[model samples]
Target: MVLRLNIDQIEPATRDWICKVQIVEIGRPRESLDKKCTFQNLILEDEQECQIRAVMYTDEIEQYVSTLKLFNTYLISTAKVKVSLTSYGKPIHRFYWILDKETVIEEIKPSDEVEKPLSPPNKLTITSFDRIPHLMVDSTAEIDVLAVVLHCGPQKTAGRSHHKCREITLCDNQQNQFLFTLWEDFGEIEGHEIYSKMATQRDLLVILGRSIGISTYQGLSLQTRYNSTVRVNPNYPQAVALLNWAKQNKTMLLSSPSDTTSTSSSITPMIVTPSGQQLLSIADISSAASMGVFCVNAEMAILDEFQDFCVLECSGCKQKKRTKDRKDFHCPKCNRKTSLVPRCSFQIDLIDNTATTTASISAELGEKLLSMTAEDIFDITCTKRQSLSLNPVHEMLSTKVFDIQLRKSSWTSSNTTTTTLSILSYMEKQHPPQSTTDRTSKKIKPLEISEVEVMPTTAAAAPSNAVGKLQPPTPTKKV
Candidate 1:
């Protein structure tokens, strides 16, 4: 008989010991940049409910990846134990195991005791939204949060690889709203479920983000890291409290002043994004304009080296499409047959003598200004995997002044409303300067070469193969 060990008892010094563990969660298989290595992690919990991470790689991945079932108790032995390089955003265990060919995995008999099945960790503590900022100060720290689902964004493919990504907003008891990104499997599976349910059961669901990774980049947002956990409507007690809190504050949670008004919204509050186009300076931008479009002259720069400038949007509802396969999918929100089309939507900053302001540019106007359609840009950036940031045409366009048509807009965050501007259209404030290559464009010939010669005659009889060719109506004679 072999000696058995608990997960917490296994260490590097332990030898020839078997551990009975139930697979709690299976992580997504990850591939190396070179494609030479592939690996996945299985979170295992022992009888004491202590957890550890076990990894399987390459050929071993092909052999047993499908054989293992979640929450199934198995006896694992002879796996290599190693110290964890980084502990943040992973299992609490200080060590992890690497399974190899010598490893033996056998299912435990049904009559024997199984530690637990489908049970979330008991130690998870929900952090209040107010403290999220404090956690951000330590990038290495992981956070657990419980919040109500407020809004869901359409799925978007990023980079040339088209890695799937989706964004959703959540609200907490403090009424703070924050954007969280669901990536990889979270985006493909859970994101769609949340979005579909949102149509009918909008305010009912509360989410628990366990071991979530935080980012301070554009703003504070939550994201999923490798082996991160996200549970929707989990049976946790906090889920109940958050759901009740959400229902009680449903009025405040779902209210949007921008939704009620068109063209412009009043200065009245909670992130005002006036739909009207206006401008002057980014810093001076405020609801005081309650105005129409305005112009500004500024040196422009494409802040991002490369990014998706457009997304597939439903023609009917105008919401972003979240499906991975865009060829054929229905928009559940509109409950109608709809097709996806490229929409012109991107942000850029313009700096004038006074201040620099970032603004949004829409389709028809942006296409005219850039001389490149949204569809073409999407193909180049996301399909062809090319960077437009350094293109000569874009560089030259940035050198010219812009007649920016601004629109007022507002965004609600942390329960506060602030006004912002968007661009309805933009064009060169002055005629574009002549290029050196166009020097001979306006030169005229010395001869009377401008006159055109007109040559026309009745066409010959059509060939047998030209059956569908028009006969020009035989030039019908007057009555």
Candidate 2:
């Protein structure tokens, strides 16, 4: 008998266990130091979502990794579990399962019972922007949101990794404006196609099964995950209703103040960190300016080495300082002789599967994460080494994972829209909190909704404890 172990239940100490999981995403194969490994993000569900990351070392499990298909369920056993090694890989769970030589893998036959729940959900039960506050913090609760496409940014590679992303600004009937970020292949073509029609006519965009979360800087934004689907101008009843509502509210959305007015104001400022410290992809930093400061757990080696990773900054305003006499320093922002602090103003480029972005760490925080003072890095860079050895900064940051506290700062005026990240604090160790389901299941007051937004009289009378199940998709006439 195959022992079905949930992804969340698998820990570093667990061994010789069986896990039935669907391969949700396959990362590009990476070759490092004469060894190749591929990372796969898997999902295990038993009436609830449980996600985890698994790695296949090339020497032991290369053949199995190549034959695995995305969205296909497999029963895997004899796998090794270890504390997650890399943070920049954007691990889905706190711990990662490793497939070694002894692992056994088999594909399960698809069946009616399995197919019904496993398929991508087609019907979208729309959630209003005002109800965003009710969304459980730091948890990936499936949500459907409908809005009119206002703007779509060009798609670009995010970090040093294989992640790609695009930005979309949307508005709803209630003059609620939101920022939806598309990662990887989600809405890649649809965003561009909608961009062309945005100026010509009103276009309704439906984001189904998108992960909704609140951030510290950009407030609430829609994030696309591996299972999320995006459709433009679909011929559904909800889409038609939203289209009409958008048409009625076009004038209000246009006249509203872009800088001050935001849909996030209706929601509270509390954003729980999912996977600890709201583990965000590199691509999320650009649109997270309004969400406030958040934390990301990333591997130390994910960043590239450069000289400017360490520099001098003014202690008063935390801005870069300019020196005329090498002793006296002047800050451009303060424009006064300020005491220049030798700090690490490291511009580290971080890459993950979703996207890539550069993060600038403060000297004090950089020293803590790297375990090396700015002066130590300066000495190593300034003085030539006779033998081959890694730089002091690289030696410390190259192979470790850290939970980094990042706050959004200014951005460069370049076309790429580079966002600056100020590191507040960092720790080399991470302790996984209770599972999301356990945390979210805790008692919280229900949100009050108006009559119009409530369900129909018949459905509203259904059992209070009933969980809504997805109905099979029906054929509908194209709009």
Winner by TM-score: 1
RMSD of each: 19.7, 23.7
lDDT of 2: 0.48
Model 2, span 129-238: residue lDDT tens: 65554452444454657776655667754322325666666666655555666765554665566666665765335433333333222234566654344657655566
Q: State every prediction's TM-score relative to the real structure.
A: 0.48, 0.35
Alpha-carbon error at 240 in model 1, in Å? 5.3
Candidate 1: RMSD over Cα atoms? 19.7
On the 0 to 100 scale, the lDDT of residue 164 in model 1 is 71
Name the runs in model 1 displaced over 4 angstroms: 58-67, 87-91, 108-110, 113-121, 157-164, 183-189, 200-203, 237-252, 256-479
Encode model 1's per-residue lDDT on 1-479: one tens digit a residue: 56788988889988889987777667657765468999887778787888777888988888886678776778899789999866455456789999888999887656656642334444445677656644554656777788888777678653223367777777776655556788867888878888888877746578877668876321346777666667677655667777888888788777732122122221111111112224455334432333223445455544543444666766554556544234756667557676776664555555555455455554444444445666776677666766554476456755576555444433333443334445533444456434312211221211111123312111111001101111101122222
lDDT of 2 at 205: 50
- Candidate 1 residue 129 C-alpha distance from true site, Å: 2.4
